[model samples]
Target: MQALAGFLWWAAVFLSPVVREATLGNLDPVAVAVFDIPLFVVASAVAAFGVKAAALVSAGWTGAVAVALAIYATVTTEAGWGVLGMGAATAGSLIALCLVLLGRVPTAWIIRGPFAFRPAIPRPTAASHVASTFGQIVLFWGFFLAAIPFAVAFLEGRWAVVLLFPSFAAPVGVAVLILASALGISAAVAMSTLGNGTPLPSAMPNHLVIAGPYRWIRNPMAAAGILQGAAVGVILQSWLVVAYAVVGSLVWNYVVRPLEEADLEERFGEEFRQYRDAVRCWVPRGSKTLRSQKP
Candidate 1:
């Protein structure tokens, strides 16, 4: 159910100003942006309180928002109502299907965020860990980043012109992208080889990875990602990309990290807590080295 909400929210964001423009031609993008990922994020936050009534209210609001969008479409555009109806139906179906699937799965196996215990599931094999990390990378780099240029074009009602790569100050952008890629990839590799797992919570680093770039900062991968995003923003000459990176980082700091720390404490116990005490989540502390264990 949560995944469905997330997907619907994402789909709304992906379609974005195109949907806005086509449906409500002169509507402010800012208003629509409010209902974008931020809305779903807020809903998720409310749901996280573990109050069923509150969660249900949030879900109800989400549905109401969908219907309001449908009505807005009906009033404004010729074909928008049809498009909105289809989108609503699709979102509803996906939510229903997910609820059914979740019903069959143990609550223990259901993933909530960056960190959580999964008692019903077996620990990942080394290969599975590597694969999951690579998959996430592909989604982050290949899919999300690749989709942005096209998404922007769609927002501008220029679907005939789909651009997949960043292009403004190409030379500098390429250098920056390459450097960030090196950093992120190296960090991921260290997580796999030293930690014996992936950066993802699902295939979490089994060992406290204090090697390689991790020796520099606790979250080299996230830093690299943000840097890469900044590079892309520079390359494309788009503040939007830069803003996305900033928001992503903020979400990690405020939302993802604390939960992740809690889960690490639950899993690795005092070992992780001690590591957290020693290392900064973003900034690297004063440099010091010790012989590392490869567990």
Candidate 2:
């Protein structure tokens, strides 16, 4: 996958000049050949050969160059398609970089090494759990959903890349927001009361929680959060914010989920394994299946 991503990154960068010329009525093929081609070739080669350190450096360099090009195009070019193309290239480069990083490091270390969950001593009281959950909701809702979308809008405005949502999307956005919020609240309540812990990994629950939303889905909180993020993007009418939400979900799924599940497997063993096998991660199972499964 790393090799494939590197090759794709190279191909995208290699073709970018033609894309730019076709979209913006400008030609600068030499600039791409001189600046981008060689670096990406090296990145691809290193990744293909499994040279971990070299792959990391080269992929990071490729991503940096892509980001610079994207910013330059956004700021200087009048062509929206050109800017969007650059953004896609930038995203590809960053994904390739992430692949390199993930390939080089142990997956378990990502969630367990530096950011390992520390179970509360003497157990937290119900009031403590409530306070913690409230704080988390405020932080996630305020910073991630509200502040970040506004910030992206501000940047888009400054860069003249503003894209607005249709008027008809407002009701759909509101409905999704309400449903996702309800799911998140229910999941949090289940974790606090049944599992005897808060949602924060630093203060994770003591018992396996397979009640409420968890009886049907393995990660109701994560599902709810991702959906809520996308809903906010719809409400704010920002494609960039929606992309941000998608990127967050990918990070959580690939990077965080493994560590979390690893910890669970280590602690709960057969119980967690059984629950995991029975429930889908993001999708809720049917009521018929829920009836058959033991929580």
Candidate 3:
């Protein structure tokens, strides 16, 4: 909800003609389009700080820029293509850039040690670490460096039709990609939910998540990641997404999980071991299960 509101509000600012006429000055549509790309990128990047405020602020700002570009394209003569193209570029870059910054920002800036300003509760466990981590890494790289390819593909109408199919055959290839990406994202989210935000350092106080999706899957975040990946694949219609989903899932299962277990074992010792036995690792062993049993 906050995200939606922020997006709409900022979007208005971006689309305002006050910016366009003042800058472009009756230039050809193509020239204006070319010019606006850099402007949007710079504007969005600069306005993007607020890691402690709320996740939506970043998203809202980016969305607004995209909306602005779209609105500009529609309003201007012979600039429809340019408008949408720039809008897409703006949206992709902003999201990617903001996320990368958020992921890297020191915990101190966002939280005054305890009082979580943005996502509120400092570093409270997100519902899904698998999903969260994977999503974060992807956004960090995908949005930052790889945005150009994505923009080109999207503008070409490569994966858009997946949004409306069976009505099919228009571009079935893209649809498959979207589905695969969604699955991967869902899986990652589900897996992360297993431990609710990676059991942060004891020195850093935060909420201990034990309910909602956390209760069921032990790692709903990971599951969500699988879903996210599949969704992206479908949305992008890219084989590379599928490969990523598969490889990433495997790495999480074989590598990341084991390492995490080792750390937990050392930290919580027998208590964590007991929890591990009862709580079926990746998938839920069912309800009425205990967090720690004597064995």
Candidate 4:
């Protein structure tokens, strides 16, 4: 039911401007933009209460902004220039907003004009502790640095090279997929955190996660990374990026995450083992759920 509402809300965002244009025949994009902002503000506030809600809100806001921008462009100026600006902003914003919703993916917020840290809580189980802390430091921090070029290439200029990837498509498709995957990942992270972390959603990461996406697959977050990364690669068409995706995914799975998981197991002991047994490391092989495990 929640997913359905989210999809409908998202669909409305993309379809609204078109509907307005079709019905009204002509309208100002600025007016559309003005109307759209409130929708996002309301959605964001509502999403604050829960993870699925947050994912839906993020998608709603993103679709609203993009479509509004498109309408604004079509009505005010030539579609080409307006599209370029909107496209750039949407791509950048998708990554930013999506990352923010994935609670496990760390990000900072500005409070009083200064950046305030809001990191993910460390896992208390042996499963989470194995990743070399240094590896995480490098990958996440590396993401920060990588974000610059990604934004620059995606928005500021057309790096002719981006035309090659399979997943890369037209601007509209790319935007939609990015937003969708972000919400999906946000949902996965929410499940992981709630199931494995503290009982209170906002409390902290308290244990290793091996349910939901973890049941079907080991690293849903990494899958999201690949999706978003591919979106960027498609947008930029940089061979380096394509290569980066291949190398990065392998390393994250084989080299980095296992360490984190091992540490988690060591920390939590038999409790972690019971969770692991009930849940597949990365494959959801059976109908059973870990809901009946020993606490």
Which candidate's TM-score is highest? 2
Q: Candidate 1's residue-wise lDDT over 1-295, tens digit each?
A: 5535555644664477665455445656457556644545455455455544444545565566666655554455433433444355445433433444353323333346544543212344556666767887998787556677434323322212113544546678779899999999988888876676777666677677777887667788988888787777666665556556777788677666666667778878877666667777778777654345453
lDDT digits (tens) for residues 150-223 of candidate 2: 88765565455667778988789889999999999988987877676788877888888888888888999999
RMSD of 3: 14.6
Q: What lDDT score belongs to each candidate, Candidate 1 first?
A: 0.60, 0.71, 0.45, 0.48
TM-score per prediction, in order, is: 0.56, 0.76, 0.35, 0.39
Q: What CA root-mean-square deviation does each model show from the true structure?
A: 10.4, 4.5, 14.6, 18.4
Off by over 4 Å in 2: 1-18, 21-29, 41-47, 50-57, 77-105, 112-114, 157-164, 287-295
lDDT of 2 at 74: 58
Better of 2 and 3 by TM-score: 2
Stretches off by above 4 angstroms in model 4 are 1-168, 171-180, 183-204, 210-212, 281-283, 292-295
**Pick by TM-score: 3 or 4, better one:** 4
Q: Write the per-residue lDDT of candidate 3 for residues 132-159, one digit (tens) a residue.
A: 4565657744762247436544443421
Worst 10 residues of 2 by lDDT: 286-295
Predicted structure 2: lDDT: 0.71
Instruction: Give the per-residue Cα lDDT of candidate 4 at 241.
Output: 56
List the candidates ranked by lDDT, beginning with the highest. Answer: 2, 1, 4, 3
